[model samples]
Target chain A: MIRAEKIFKNFGDQAVLKGIDFTFEAGKTNLVIGKSGSGKTVLLKILVGLFQPTSGNIWYSDINLVSADKESLRKLRMEVGMLFQGNALFDSMTIEENIRFPLDMFTTKTLKEKKDRVNYCLERVSLEGNNNKFPSEISGGMQKRVGIARAIVLNPKYLFCDEPNSGLDPQTSITIDELILNITKDNKITTIINTHDMNSVMEIGENICLLDKGKLAWQGSKDEVLISKNEVLHDFIFASPFLQKLIENSK
Target chain B: MNLNLFYHFGNFVIWQAQIFKRPENGSMYYKETVRQMYDIGIGSLPIVFLISIFIGAVTAVQFYYQMAGSLIPAYYIGYIVRDMTIIELAPTITCLVLAGKVGSNMAAEIGGMRQKEHIDAMEIMGVNTSAYLILPKLIASLLMIPILVCAAALIGILGAYIASVPAGLFSSAEFIKGVRSFFIPYNVIMMLVKAFVFAYILTGVSCYQGYFVKGGSIELGQASTRAVVYSNILILLADYIIALILTA
Candidate 1:
C-alpha cells in the first residue's frame, strides 16, 4: 500500500495539488480521476517521484519517498514500473528487446534466461508471436500491450500507469484495463492509474480518488459512483448529456 | 544574461556529477558506447573529409596567390598549409563542423526522447537517465573526435599537395620537401589537446541542452540550434585559450 499524506505541490505561485491525503491499496486498480488540469497527472507524477511535492510525505508502505536518499530511491525504483500515456516504448527496439530492457539493465540473467522472460512477458500480454516486430509496425492497442509487457517484465511491486487509455478506442481501452486489472490481481501489485476516462472509472475503478481544481473532491469505489452525492464527481463523470440520461434511465 | 549564465553553469556542473556516477551495468554502457562510436565517428567521416579537403585546397591556393612574386619559396605554401592544418585548422575547424553535425544530432535525439517520455520511463525503471543517455556519447566523442581530427589533418595536407603539385604551381618534390621541413612534433600534441577539449565541450553542451529540454517540437528545435551555436562558440574560445597556454 502507498499512502500520500497532505501532499501539496506548487509550481511557482500556482498550486497544483492542495494537501491531497489518500491511500492506494495493494492488489487493486487505484484510479486518480479528474478533468484536464485537475492535478491528476501532477499527483501521479509526485507519487512516482518524477516531481517532488512542495510539501508532504509520500509513504510507500513504511518508507518516506519524499526524503529517501539517492541510493534508496534507486533501489526503490527497481521495484517500480510505469506505463506512460504515449506507451514510451523505445522505438528503435523490437518488441522482444523492449520487454527485455529492464532485465538486461538490472539482472545477471543469461541470454537464454532473458529471452525466456521476454517470451513469457509477450505471451502474458497475448502478443506471443509478435516478438520481432517494431512498435511502429504494430497497432496502437498492440503498442499499449507491449508497454504493459515491458512494465511487468521486471515483476515490479508497484505499477503506475499515466493515462493508459488515452487515444485508444473504447473496445481496446477495455482490453487494456482488464489486462492491468488482471496483472494487479495476479502479481498483487499496488497499481495506480491516472486517467480521466469515465468508462475506466466505471468499469475497473475498484478504488477511485476524484480531484477537482487540485483538491480531493471525492473518493469511493465504482459501486459508490452511481449513488454518490458529490457534485464534483457528478459533474466530471456525467458531464455529457448522454451519460446523464443513461444514469437517469437506469435509475 | 549574466545571472542566467551562472544558473546554467551551476546546473551543468551539478548535472555532470550525476552523469559520471558508477554505471548500473558496465556491459550495457559498453554496448551503448560502441553504438555511439559508430554514429559519431563513422557517421561523421564523409562530412569531415569534404570540409578538410576544401579547407586545405583553399588555403594552398590562396597562399600561392599571396606569395606569387615574394621572396618566400613556393614550397613554403605546403609547409604553411601543413602547420596551419595541424596547429589550428584541423582541430578547430573540424570540431566546429562537428559541433554543427554530431552535437546537434545528439541534442535532437535526446530532446526527442525527453519530449516522448522515454527518459522518464527509464528513470522510473531505476536507470540513471543522464548517465545512460549522455555518457556513451561523451565517451564516444572523447575517443573518436581526436582520431577524426588526425584524419582531417592528414587529408588537409594531401589536399594541399593535390592542389599545388598537380596544378604545376610547384613540383611534387618541392611540396613534399616543404611538408618534410620544420616538422614540429609538439604542434601535433597541441592539435590533440584542442581536439580533446573541443570534444568534451561539444558533447557536454549538446547533451546538457537536450537532457533538460522542456515543451514541444519548437522548443526542441531551439535547443538543437542552441547546442550547435553554443558548442561552436565554446570550441573556438577553448581553441584560443589552449593555443595561448601551449604556445606560452
Candidate 2:
C-alpha cells in the first residue's frame, strides 16, 4: 500500500538515494536491506514523512508524503506506527506509559480502555508484567520488545521498523524477527523493515529489496535470494567469507 | 550533524505561536508551567535560599568594612542589599542557576528524546511536539522565575538584616525605612519583566538546542552543554538590554 517513485535524496556532495523505485504490498514484510550508509534509514524516513525527498514522490495510497501538509501528515501519521532503531522509549515514562503514548495522543479512549490496550500490546511482545519499569532498567532485548509493542499500540495500518536488530544478539534477533513476522501475519498490516541482517531476510522477509549505494541492486523473496546467480547480489549477501562458505555448503 | 541556528529560532517562533493560538494548547502551557515550577523552583528552593542568605550575610560583612561606623547611614545597608539583589543578583544569578539546572536539563531531555525519535513519535501521534514540549517551558519560566527571584530577594534582605543587627549596625525600623524610602513600583515591575525575559532565554534557547539534537546520545549531551553556555551568555545580554530600558 506504499509506493516510492524515482526518489532522489542527497546530502551536500553525496547522493544518498538515487532514482529508486519500489512498491510495498499489504499484509507482508517488505524489507530494505543494505550495508551501512546505504540510505535505508533515509528512504524509510522519506516514506514516513520525516524527511523530504530531493526529487520524486512517495504515495501512501494516493497522497504524496513528500509534500503533505502538517494536518495531513498528522492524519497519515496516525495510521502509521514506527519502531525506531534505538527503541526510543521516553526515559521519563514507564513501559506502560511509553506503550500508551500514541493512544494518549491519538485516541480518546477511556483510561480503562487505554490501560487494557497497553496490557495487550505488552503481552503481545512478551512484556506483560514490566509495565512500571523504566527504559534504563530494562534489558536491550526487552527494550526492543517494548519498542515493537509501542509501535503497534495504536493498531496502525502501516508499520515501519528501522534496524530492529541493530543491538540485539543473534538469538534475540531471530526472536524479534519472528515476533515481527507473527505480528505482521496476525494484523495483516502493511509492514516494512529496514535491516542489514541477512538472517532476518531469509527468515521473515516475504518481499526483499537490496540497496547498494543508493541503487536498487536486487528485489526478490527468500527463495529467489538464495537461488540468484547475480554476482553483485552474491557478494552482498555473502560478503563475509564464513557466511559465503556456509551458504555454499548448504547449497 | 547539520545545525542551522536561525532555522531553530524560526521553529521556536512557530511553536510558541501555535501554543498561544489555541486555548487548549494555552491551558496546557500553563499546566506545564506549574509542573516546571515544581521542578525548577520548589525543588531547588533550599539551595537558592541558602545561597542568597549566605551571599547577603557575607556582603553585609564586606560592605561594613568600608561604611560600617562612619558617616554613611547604617540603615543604608538594607537599601544597598535591595538595590543589588533586585538589579543584578536576582535576575542574572537566578538565570545562571537555571542555566545549570533547567537549561541544561531542557536541552538534554528534549535532545535525548530527539535522539530517540520520541519527538518524531509525538509528531506522528498527531500531537504538536513543539507545543507540548517548549511552550510549557516558556510558560513555566514566565510564571515561576519571578516567584523564585522574589523569594531570593526576600531571603537576601533578611540575611543582610541578621548579619548587621548583631553589630548594632542598624535598628530594624530604621532599616525598614531605608528600604522603603526610595521604593519604585516600576523598578519591581521592571525586575519582574527582566526575570521573565531571562527565563525565556534559559528555556527558549535550551529548548531550541535540545529540539534539534541529531545523531545519538553523544550529540544530545553536546547540545545540553552548548545550550547552557549559549543561553547563559544570552541571559547576560538580556540583562544589559533590560537594564538599559529600565534605567533609561
Candidate 3:
C-alpha cells in the first residue's frame, strides 16, 4: 500500500494540493477523481515522484518515497510502473520492443525468455498478435493496451496511471478499466489511477478519493457515491442538467 | 538578460551532470551509441561532401582571381586552399552546418519526446532519462564529427584540384607541390581540436535545449530554433577562443 500523509504542494505562491492524507490499498483500484483544475493530476504526479510536494510524506510500504535516497529511489522505481495519459510508447520501436524495454534494461534474461515475457504481456493486454506494429499503426485503445503491457512487463509492485481513459470511447474505457483492475488484483500491486471519467468512477473505483479546489473533498468506495450527502460530490457527479433531472425524477 | 544567460548556463551544467551516471545496461547503451554513430556519420555524408566541395571550389576560384598577374606563384592558390580548409574552413564550416542539421534534429527529437511524455515514461521506469537520451548522441558526435572534418579537409583539397588543375589555372604538378609545401603537422592537430570542441558545443547545447523544453508545439519550435542558433553562436565563439589561445 502507498500512503500520503499531510501532503501539500505549491507552485510559486499558488497552492495545488492542500494538506491531505490518503491510503491507496494494494490489490485494489484506487482512483483520484476531480474536475479540471482540481489538483488530481498534481497529486498523482507528486505521488509518482515526478513532482515534489511542498511538505508531506509518501510512504510506499515501509519506505518514505518522498525522502528516499537516490539508490533507494532507483530501486523503488524498478518495482514501480506507470501508464502515461499519452501512452508514451517509443514511436520508433515496435510494440514488442516497447514491452521488452524494461526487461532489456533491467534483466539478464535471454532473448527467448524476454520474447516469451513480451508475448505474455501482449496477450494479457489482448494485443497478442500486434507485436510488430508501431504505435501509430494501431488505434488509440490498442495503444493504451500496449502502454499497459509495457508498464507490467517488469512485474512492478506499484502501478500509477494518469488518465487511462481520456481519449478512449466508452466501451474501450470500460475494457481498459477492467484490464487495470484485473492487473491490480492479479499482481496485488498498489494501483492508483488519476481520472475524471464518471464511468470509471462508478465501475471499478474500489477506493475513491475526491479532490475539490486542491483539498480532499471526500473519500469512499463507489457505493457511497450515490447515497453520500457530500454536496461537492453531488454537484460533480451529476453536473449535467439531464443527469441532475434524472436523479431528481428518480428521487 | 545576463541573469537569464547565467541561469540557463547553470541549468545546463547541472543537466550535464545527470548524463554521466552509470548506464543501467551497457549493451543497451552500446546499441544506442552505434545507432547514433550511423545517424551522425553515414546519415550526414552527402551534405558534408557537397558543402566541402563548394567551399574548396569557391576558395580556389577566388584565390586564383586575386593572384592574377601577381608575383606570387600560381601554385600558392593550392597551398592557401589546403591551409584554409585544414586550419579553419573544414572544421568550422562543416560543424556550423552540422549544428543546424544534427543539432536542430536532436532538439526536435528530444523535445517531441518530452512533449509526448516519453522522457517522463522512461524516468518512471527507473531509467535516467537524461543519460539514456543524451549520452549516446554525445558519444556519437564526438567520435564521428572529427572523422567527417578530416574527410571534408581532404575532399576540399581534391575539389581545389578539380577546379584549378583541369581548368589550366595551374598544372597538376604545381597544385600538388603547393599542397605538399609548408605542411604543418600542428595545423592538423588544430583542426581536430576545433572539431572536438565544436562537436561538444553543438551536441551539448542542443541536448540541453531539448531536455528542459516546456509547453506545446510553439514552445518546442522555439526550443529547436534556439538549439541551432545557440549552438552556432557558441561554435563560432569557441572557434575564436581556440584560435586566440592556440595561435597566441
Candidate 4:
C-alpha cells in the first residue's frame, strides 16, 4: 500500500503537482491518468522517490518516504521495481543481464542462481531464447515485455510503471495492460501505472485516480468514474469524440 | 567575472566524493576501476610503447643530424632520447595518447549512460550513482597510468637506440654512456609523479563532463568533446606546473 499527502512539486516557478493526495491499495493495479503536463509523471516520480517533492510526504506501507534516510530509501528501492517509459534497458548488456541486474546489485544470489531466475522470468514473459539478444535486436513490443520481466524479476513488493503503453499499437497495448493486470494479481504486489490510455483505464483499472492541472480530480473504480457527473472528470473522460458519442449513446 | 567557479569546482569535487562514500558500492567501484585500468593501462601499452620507441628513434636520428657538424659526440643521441622521453614524451605525450583513448572512452561510456537515463535509474534504485560509477574509474586510472608512463619512457629510449644503432652512431657502450652522462635521477621520478597526476586529471575531468550532460545523444557527444577539450587543456597546464616544480 502507498499514500501521498499534499504533495507539491515544481520546476523552478512552474507548479506541476500542486497539493495532490491519493492512496493505492495493495494487490491491485492503481492507474494515474492525466493529459500531458498534468503532473502525472511528476507525481509518479515523487512516489518512487526519484524527485524530491517541494512539500509533502509519501508513505510506502508505514514508512514515510519523505523523511527516510539513504538506507531506508535503498531498502524501499530494493523492494521496488520500475518499468520505465522507454524500457531503459542497458544498451550494452544482453536481455539476461538486464533482467538479472537487480539481482546482481541487490541480491546475494550466486551467478548460477541468478541465471536460473533470469531464465524463469524470461520464460514467464514468453521470452525464452531471446535472453542472448541485445535490446536493439528486439522489437518494440518484445522490449516492453522484457522491461516487464525485468521489473518483476526481483519479485518486488511494489511495481511502478511510467507510460508503459506509450508507443505501442492498440492491440499490443491491450496485451501489455492484460499482462500487467495478470502480473499484479499473480504476485499480489501493489502496482502503480502512470498512463493516458483510456482503453487501459476501461480494461484493467482496479483503482483509478484522475489528475487535472496538478489536482486530484477523482479517485475511485471504473464503475464510479462512469456514473460520476463531475463535469471536469467528464470532460477528461469524454474529450475524444468517439468516447463522447459513447457516453451520449449510453444515456 | 564573478562566476563562482570555485563553488562549481567544489560542488563537482563533492559529487565525485559522494560516490566513494557508500560501503555497498565499494566492490563494484573497485571492479570498475580494475577493468578501466586494464583497458586504459594494459590495453594501451602497445600503442604507447610503439610511439615512444618511434619518438626515441627519431630523436636520435635528429640528434645525429644536428650534432653532425658540432664538436658534440655521436652518443649524444642517447642523451636526447633520454631527456625527451623522461621530460616530454613519457608524461605529456603519453597522457595525451591516453586522453584520446581512455578519457574518450570514459566520456562516451558515462555519456551514453546519461543519454539513456541509466544514471537516474541507478539513483532511483537507491544506489549512489557516483560510488557505483565514478570512483572505480578514477581509482583505476590513478593506479595503472604511472606504470604505463614508466613503460613509455623505458621503451621510448630503447626505440631511439634501435634507430640510432643502424646509423653507425654510438656503439652500444657509447650509447649507454651518453644516456648516463647527464642523467638526473629526479627527472625519472618526476615523470612518474606527473603521469599519476595526468591520469587522475584525465579520468576525473572526462567523467565530470559526462555526468552532468543534459539532452540526449547529441549532448553526450558534447560531453565527450568537453572531456577531450578540458582534459587536453588541463594536461598542458599541469605539464607547466610539473615543469615549474621540477625546475624550482
DockQ of each candidate, alpha-carbon based? 0.94, 0.52, 0.91, 0.55
Local distance difference test scores for all models: 0.94, 0.84, 0.94, 0.86
Per-residue alpha-carbon lDDT of candidate 1 for residues A1-251, written as tens digits (9 for 90 to 100): 99999999999999999999999999999999999999999999999999999999999888899999988898889899999999999999999999999999999999999999999988898999999999999999999999999999989999999999999999999999999999999999999999999888888999999999999999999999989999988888778899779879999
The C-alpha RMSD in Å for every predicted model, in order, reads: 0.9, 2.8, 1.0, 2.5
Worst 10 residues of 4 chain A by lDDT: A100-109
Clashes of each: 0, 0, 0, 4
Residue B122 Cα positional deviation in candidate 4, in Å, after optimal superposition: 2.4
Candidate 4 lDDT over B50-73, as tens digits, reads 878887888888888888889878
Which runs of model 3 end up more than 4 angstroms from their true locations?
Answer: A248-251
lDDT of 1 at A110: 100
Predicted candidate 2 versus true structure: per-residue lDDT over A44-141, tens digit per residue: 98888778889999988888888888667768877888888877788888999889877766577888999999999999999899999999999999
Clash pairs detected, candidate 1 = none
1 or 4, greater by lDDT: 1
TM-score of the first chain alone, every candidate? 0.97, 0.96, 0.97, 0.96
TM-score of chain B of 2: 0.87
